[model samples]
Target chain A: MDLLLQLTINGLSMGSIYLLLGISWGLIFAVTRTFHFAHGATFVVAAYSAYFFQQLGFSLILAAVGSVLAAVLFGMAVEGILYRYLRKAFASHLVVFVAAIGTLITVENLIAMGFGTDVKTLEGFPIKVIKIGKVGFNNLHVVMFATAGILFFLLMLYLHRTKTGKALRAVISNPEMAEVIGIDTRKYFLLAFALGSLLVAPAAFLVTIERGATIDLGHWAILYAFMPVIIGGIGSLPGAALAGLIIGLAESIGIWKISSQWQVGIAFVVLVAVMILKPTGLFGFRVYRGKI
Target chain B: MILEVKNLVGGYQNKRVLHGLSFSMGDGEVVGTIGHNGAGKTTLLKSLFGLLPPWEGQILFRSHDITGRKPDSNVKEGIAYMPQGQGLFPDLTVMENLEISCFGLDRKTLKKRSQQVFELFPILEERKRQRAGTLSGGEQRMMSVGLTLMHEPTLMFLDEPSLGLAPRIVQLVMENIIEINRRFKNSILLVEQNFEQVKRVAGKIIVIKLGQIVFSGILDPALDKRELWKYF
Candidate 1:
């Protein structure tokens, strides 16, 4: 019984990571039809960026600053150069999808060539387990959960409260109408990509110390992200968070029933079953553009 | 002149919709643009707003040669277009739609406009928190027009505001138009299909057929539905 409780706590902590990742991906995807296959590379790159800054004897705050600036601009550049030109091609949205995939491949290869395939963890940031009765969680988990909570709260406020946020919502709703109404949809797209990069920063930072950073880290996290996003409903932020928790708890508990090697497969089976029955998932209001 | 389109030509990729279409609007004047279903009424407004590019010709606004500029630039220059076909941000609530239209304005101004929108549309005020996608046809039309009102532009371009609205609601909408004109004294270009609604508030009326001005004069009832159908 104590084991069950311990695993639940462990699950919630891991859920925090995926929750952040899912909401970020869903938010970006909901706004810009650009698949941003380069999204995952941005994650690992941020991890590496922070590590590099740490090696330079910077404080945690400075390291965060380094990763954020690098990630934000990289996101902006991706939207500005690659996606902006693609929008003018006057082709179907599928063209952009393919181009985004190409971008993903190029970024991943570049990272592999530079950083090599090996994962690299930062030197100073180390996890120490904080035991609570029968359940034990690292200080990293508490910090990550707190950070994720703050991010989610801020994101909600931004999307629902502010003016530019309303504009973003409008652009996401109807690109043509937003254009006619004098919204620079291109600018909105750029902002959305930047937001994606910003959201990935914490997730990358969260895992970099314990798990290390690698070119494939982004893809690794995305595998977990997909389940939460699907179950939560693609564009629903709150739904994604809830699903992330559910997935985390399910994966942790499934370890009791099946081999740890089959955890990923078991999650997929659950997701496929839910998708077949409830295609809209928990939040049924997600609006997606073009043929997915 | 507040607006002038001279020798303007524009259209889709292969098909030309507006050919040398020329017109002018004056400050404090209500100009009604009437046309058939495909007479390019919406296209004319779009071209002026720079949604559709003019292949050749000059578009002058207030003695400024405002040609070939983007819509955002034109919007900043005091042009708020209430697009035809009820172009609205569905999935957004009424309040959200208003907030987006009030872009970059301070919170105080937004608050004033929200109250003003309520004054213009009491139902909207009542349902300000409601999603626009769920609005009834009449209400959605109201929301679309209210969106344009947020910018408080000097020149208002209202396209097919009467589209799909019932006669009673249409009459109410017409009263709102007159109310707007009287209050702001802003120049208005009204694109309308219903001649009665057009004639109710329009100071001058111009009719378009097949991308050309078929009639340009004061709107007299002698030119009624039967005559209007000829253009259609």
Candidate 2:
């Protein structure tokens, strides 16, 4: 029972990371209707940017801030430059998706060539284990959960309270009507990209500190990101967060009965089960006709 | 003239819908545009409002040449377009729909405008917390018009305001359109398939067939529905 409790705590902490990734990707997809597969590249860029900044003698806090800034710029540039150009060129959804895939491949390859394929860890974090009864967790786990909770609260507040945030919601709900109402859908699309990128930075930073950064992490990050979104429903942010937690918990618990090597497979099994049973996702109201 | 479209030509890619269409409207006028399904009634509003770029010709709005300007710019310049169907965000609450329509307005103005909307459609206020998608068809139509009211637009392009509603709801919507024109002094270009409803509210009637204006004149109360059938 104690072991189960420990695993649950670990799962929740990991789930928090997945929740951040899922909502980050979900926000961009819901708002822009863009299959932004290159979001994986943005994750790698953020992690590498933090590591690069720290190597240049910046404090850990400054490095994280710098990483977020880099992620925002890179994400916006992907939308403003690549996606915009493809849209102007009259690319179909499939074509744009292919372009995004190509971008992800190119970026991952470039990073691999630049930083080498080997793992590189971020230095100077004094991680300590904390115990609650028989269950134990690191301080980093607490930080991860706190960060995700705070950010999610702030995001919900922004979406509900601010003019720009409402505009983004308007675009997500109905792009054509949003345009008619003068909400500037293009500007909101860029904003979605920026915010989406910003959301992923902490996940990238946390993961780099926990398990070190690697070029291969991009594809894994994106896979986890997409699984939660698809499992939760295409356009529901809260759904994605919940699905992320479910997947994290499922994977963690499954390891007790099977080899830990099958951890990733456990998430896939849950995804398949949800797809077969629900199809629209756990929280999806209907087949996505542009509702956030 | 508040709006003048001179030889406007535009349509979807590789297909022409509005072929050299020309018309003009005075301030605070309610002009009803009647036509068949493919008669380019919606296209005319779309082109003038900048949803679709004009292939040729000019659109002068309040004497300013706004030809080919996007919808956002046209909206900023006091044009409001309520497209066919609900023309609202279904997932958003009725209040949210109203809030987003006049996005950048200050709190005072927003409250004032929202009150004005409530005055126009009091049912909207009662259902403010309800999601717009779940509203009855008539209520959804009312909320659509209410959204346009939030910005206090000088000109409104309302496509098919009475579409797909019961006879009683249709009458109510037509009456609301009349009230909107009367109270707000907004010049309206109303598109409708049902000429009976248009005749009740419109001062002038513009008939289009296959994208060309067949008739543009006063809505004579004595005009026969049979006579209008020939144009269609």
Candidate 3:
């Protein structure tokens, strides 16, 4: 029971990380037709950015904000320079996909060169310890879970209630019509990329704060979130989030029953199974012969 | 003149669709422009809205040059366009579509503007939360026009709005167009196929054949010769 409880706490931490990732990936996919396959690079970069800022004796909050701002600006610039030209060209989107892979390689190499390939952890930040019953847990997990909840709530409110959010959805649904209706598609895309990059900042911090930062972690991290986007549903935010938690639960329980080696394989099995069952997944929008 | 297009020539890619087309509309005037399939009526409207890059022509809206701007930029200049097929985002709710057009307006202003728009199409107000894609063709047209009215444009450009609508709905839309011009004092440029429908609202007619304006005058004169029906 204690082991189950501890694993549950661990699952929460992992789930929160994937939740942020799913939201970021979902946002980019929703507003822009192309997926930022290098989205995880922003996460790793934010972790490194947060680390350097902390090394400069900046407060954690300041480091977090700085990382988010830097990532947003970089993401917007990347979309403008690369993704903007790929609009309406699915063939060219393949080129952008290769370019995304290139971005991942470039960022990882830059980080490895600057910060070295060693695992760098943010230390001495006053860790908060909490114990409930016989199970002990870190307060950061609570913070992680809480932050994910808050982020999702705020995102839902913005997407559903605010004017800008409505415009973003309109642009996503029918870009040409949105323009005639006065919603600038370009402006909405910029906002989408910025928000996506911003979501990754905390996920990066969570990863680094828990395990440590390394260049290749982004590629691995992206695969985990990508599963939810695929097996769960594409362009659906809630489906991704729910699937993130499900993945976390499966991995956590699977480790208890089987070897840790097969933990990654569990996602793939679920991916293949869910895909074969209902190709569109939990909350997929029905497409009419690829029209919708 | 509310709108002036001169020597406009453009289309998708290198294929030129419009060849030196020119026309104008005055305030509160409804102008009908007709042509056969591929006659460049839609292209002319798109060029005026800056959707396509014109090979060469200046578009003046309210005496201001707006040739190279984007669709949103044109909306800011008080020229709202409703594309053919009543181009509404089918997945979104009527309220959602309305809000998209009310982008520049603030909350309070948007509230008032929405109410005004709702009055223009009361059916849309009743189905405010319904998805646009599910509405009937006539209702969708109303919603599209309702969405356009949210922009508060002084000039409305409607492209083939009567394409698939029933005769009754077509009349409703035409009446709404006349009412819109009467209520808002907006100049309307209507690209339509239904000749009688166009005749009901349009004060002037311009016939485009293979991208050139073959006639520009009152509708009665253009339709005086029964052979002119081929141009439509």
Top lDDT: which candidate number? 2
Residue clash pairs of candidate 3: B90-B133
TM-score versus the correct structure, for each prediction: 0.90, 0.97, 0.90
Interface alpha-carbon RMSD, every candidate: 3.1, 1.3, 2.6
Q: Which clashing pairs does model 1 show?
A: none
lDDT of 3 at B9: 76
| Best of the candidates, TM-score | 2
lDDT of 1 by residue, B78-170 (tens): 888888765788788788788777777788999998788889889998888887888988899888878887878888888889888888989
Off by over 4 Å in 3: A1-8, A85-91, A125-136, A287-292, B89-92, B221-226, B229-232
**List of clashing residue pairs for candidate 2:** none
For A73-103, candidate 1 gives per-residue lDDT tens digits of: 8878888987788767665678877776676
Reference-based lDDT, residue A85, model 3: 65
- Total backbone clashes of model 2? 0
DockQ of every predicted complex = 0.47, 0.74, 0.53
The sequence of per-residue lDDT tens digits that candidate 2 reaches over residues A1-292 is: 9989888888889999999999999999999888899999999999999999999999999999999999999999999999999877778999999989888899989988888989988988889998889888999999999998888888888988888887888888888999989887888999999999999999999999999999878889899998999999988888998898888899888888999999999999999999999998988877555455
> lDDT rank, highest first?
2, 3, 1
Candidate 2: Cα lDDT at B90: 90
Native-to-model Cα distance after best TM-score fit, residue A70 in candidate 1, in Å: 1.6
Candidate 3 local lDDT, A47-90, one digit each (tens): 88888988999888888887888778878887887778666443
